[model samples]
Structure formats: C-alpha cells, structure tokens
Target: MRFVTDPELTPELIDELVDCWTDVSNAGGSVGFVPPVTADDIRATAEAAFARCGDDDHLVAGFDAEGRVACWLILGDAGSWLRAHWRWVLRVMVHPKHQGRGYGSRLMGAADAAARALGVEALHLTVRGGTGTERFYAGLGYVEAGRIPKAIRLAPGDDRDEIYMVKSL
Candidate 1:
C-alpha cells in the first residue's frame, strides 16, 4: 500500500476523482455535501476549489491492485501565516467498495507522514458531529479539540454539529 501525491492534478484526474467522490457522497458519507450527489455537482465545486488552491495544496491517494483510484484525501496548507505549521485533512474517504481493506488507514497514515515531512507539528480536520466519523478518527489517534453545535445543515430541519479534531505529529 503505497501513498502517492499529485501536486498538480490534471483535468482528467479531477473528473475521475469527482466520480470517486460522487460514489462516496451518494453512499451517505459526510463529504461536504448531501446524499444523492452527482459527479457534475462535485466537479464544479472541485473546479472552484482548484482555482483557489495554493501551490502546496495536493491530492494524496492510494490505488488498488487493479490500477484504479480507490481512495483520496486532500492536504491543505492552511493558507495563512499563523496556521502554516499545520495541514488540514479534507474529504478523506475510501470508496464503499474498498472500505475495510486497510486502505483508509494507509491513506491517513500517509497524510500524517507527509505533514511531518513538511515540518508540521499538528494536523486538523473537521467531521460532522453525532456520527461515527469522530470515532473513526479517534481510533487513528486523533483527539477531539472542539465542537460547534448546529453548524452543519443537511436539509431544512436536519442539522448536525461540526467537530474539530487534532492530531499532533
């Protein structure tokens, strides 16, 4: 299980990644969007984000033995003077078909190693509170640092807290 980083993602790569993300989102994973997501919707969002990314932002992913992209996470540089020492983990997920094969662990471990290599002392990420995501990160040695109540709204009356987690490298 080797981890690779694509610092400059191409158009084709983004399209492929959007497909992967669509699958994850449609399966009811909290990935910055509601369920029943579409590839076009995610692709447009990705285009906007790519336009704003700094040079150091990158895509960290792991491929399966069949040569398909099984999972990926974004490593954000925090994009600020004070927070430069930290990296933000964004949209980390293993496609539903690839889950429970130890791929998520390898993906997260690689993200941590990459942060350390960049002289980072801490990593940050947010997950929807009141779900199993926080537990998953805790198992990966992350500590719950904070939570904001009713911060994320999935629908009209459906809302969830936003949990902030930290892992010190």
Candidate 2:
C-alpha cells in the first residue's frame, strides 16, 4: 500500500472515498453511519472531510496496488492554541475488501508520521463501544483515555459508549 497525506480532492478520489465509507459502514465498521448506507448517504460527509485537509487538518490515504483508495484517516487540529499539541484522528476507514490486509495499520502509521511531521505530540480518537475497534487501536499503541457511557445512540434503546482513546507520540 502507498500512503499520501493532504492529497488533492479530485472527483474520482471523492467518489472512491464515498464508496469505501459506504462499504465499511455497511460491513459493521464503526464509522459515522450505520449499516445499509448508500454512497449518497456518505458523499456529503466524505466531501466535508476532504475539505478539512490543509493547514489546520490533514487527510491521509492509503492506496491499493491498483491505485485505488484502500484505507484513509484524517488528522484534525483542535482549533485552540492550548490544545495544539495534539490532533484528532477522524473518519478512519478501510475498504472492506482491503481489511485484514494490513492497510489499516499502514494508514495509521502514515498518519502518525504525518502528525509527527507537524510537530504534534499526541493523537486523539474515538470509537463506539462493542465494535471491537478498541482492540485495533490498542494494538496501534493507543490507550483508553476516557469513555462517555452510552453516548452513541444507534437506534431506539441501542446505545453504545463513546470510547475516547489517545496516543502520546
């Protein structure tokens, strides 16, 4: 996999990201949406994420051998001088077909390097409980920093904790 940071948001890249986000969400990945989502359901948000890339944020993407977006994540500034030492990692997604192929890890390692390049000292991310994403982040040297009990409501009475994780660089 090849990783790139702050890549240009071409129309094709946006489409690929929306497709990947849709697939991951439908496959039970703890992205922003629930299962059974369509590319239309994710396009707006994906484009918004793309817009965040620049001086105050970053978009790191990993591509497959065919030059398709296989995995990606965003590093966002806190927008406060007091919190500038760290960044928030958001919208982490690996194309379902690329899962278990180590693309996720490679994407994260690239994000780490990108953050370090920005002189960041830590990374913060959140995962919904019961998705097994905790273990994945833990394996990447992240630790549980806090949790908001039953913070995410997927549906009626189907709530999950919002787990806050952090990695100190």
Candidate 3:
C-alpha cells in the first residue's frame, strides 16, 4: 500500500472516497454511516472531512496496486494550541474488497508516521463498541482510555458504547 497525505481534493478523488466509504459501510465497516448507504448518503460527510485538510488536519489515504483507494483515515488537531501534541484519528475505513489485504494496518501505520512527522506525541480514536474494533487498535498498541455507554445509536434499540482508544508515540 502506498499512502499519501492531503492528496489533491479534486472531484475525482472525492468521488473515489465517497464510493469507497459507501462500499465499506455497506459491507459493515465502522465508518460513521450505517449499512445500506448510497454514495450520495456519504458524499456530504466525505466532503466535510476533506475540507478539514490543509491546516491542523490531514487526509491519509492508502492506494492499492491498481492506484485505487484501499483505505484511508484523518489526522485531526483539536484546534487549540494546548492540544497540539495529540491528533484525533477519525473515519478510518478500508474498502471491504481489500480487507484481507492488510491495508487497514498499513493505513494506520501510515497515520502513525504522519503524526510523528507532525511532531505529535499521541493519537486518539474512537470505535463504536460491540464492533470489536478496539482489539484491532490494541494490536497496534492503542490502549483503551475510556468509554461512554450508549453513545452511538444506530437505531432505537441498537445503541453502542463509544470506546476511546489512545496511543502514545
């Protein structure tokens, strides 16, 4: 996987990300939107994430051998000088078709390197509980910092805890 940061947010790149996010959500990947989502359903959020790049935030995208986005995530600053030592990792997603290819780990490794390059000391991210996403992050050396119960409501009866994980670099 070849990772690039803050790639040109052209229409083509945004469209590709929307498509990838749609597929990942539909395949049960934890990337904000629920399953059965269309590209249009994810377009606005994807655009907003892109708009966050170029300043204290960055878009780290990993491409496959064919040059398609296999996985991606965002490194976001908290917008305060006091919080400059840490970055929030958001919207981490791996195209379902490429899941078994280990792009998820590689994508995160890229995020780690990117954060280090920016003089960051810690990385924070949240996962919807019951998804077992914490285990994946733990494998990469992230520790559970805290959890907010019933924080994410996918539906009336389908609520999940929001697990906060952090890694000290």
Which candidate leads the pack in lDDT?
3
**Which segments of model 3 are wrong by more than 4 Å?**
none
Highest TM-score model number: 3
Which regions in candidate 1 have their CA more than 4 angstroms from the true location?
Answer: 51-54
Which segments of candidate 2 are over 4 A away from where they belong? none
TM-score of each: 0.93, 0.97, 0.98
lDDT of 1 by residue, 1-169 (tens): 5577764567776776788899999998888888887998788887766665546676787877876778988888787878989988998989899998988888999888878877889989999976788998999999999999999998898889999999998
What pairs collide in candidate 1? none
Clashes of 3: 0
Which 10-residue window in model 3 sums to the lowest lDDT? 47-56
User: lDDT of all predictions, in order shown?
Assistant: 0.83, 0.91, 0.92
How many angstroms is residue 164 displaced in model 2 relative to the true structure, after the best TM-score fit? 0.5
Distance (Å) between predicted and true CA of 165, model 3? 0.5
lDDT ranking from best to worst? 3, 2, 1
Model 3 Cα lDDT, one tens digit per residue, 1-169:
7899889988998999899999999998888988899998888888888898978799999988899988999999878999999999999999988888788899999999999999999999999999998999999999999999999999999999999999999
Residue 57 accuracy (lDDT) in model 2: 89
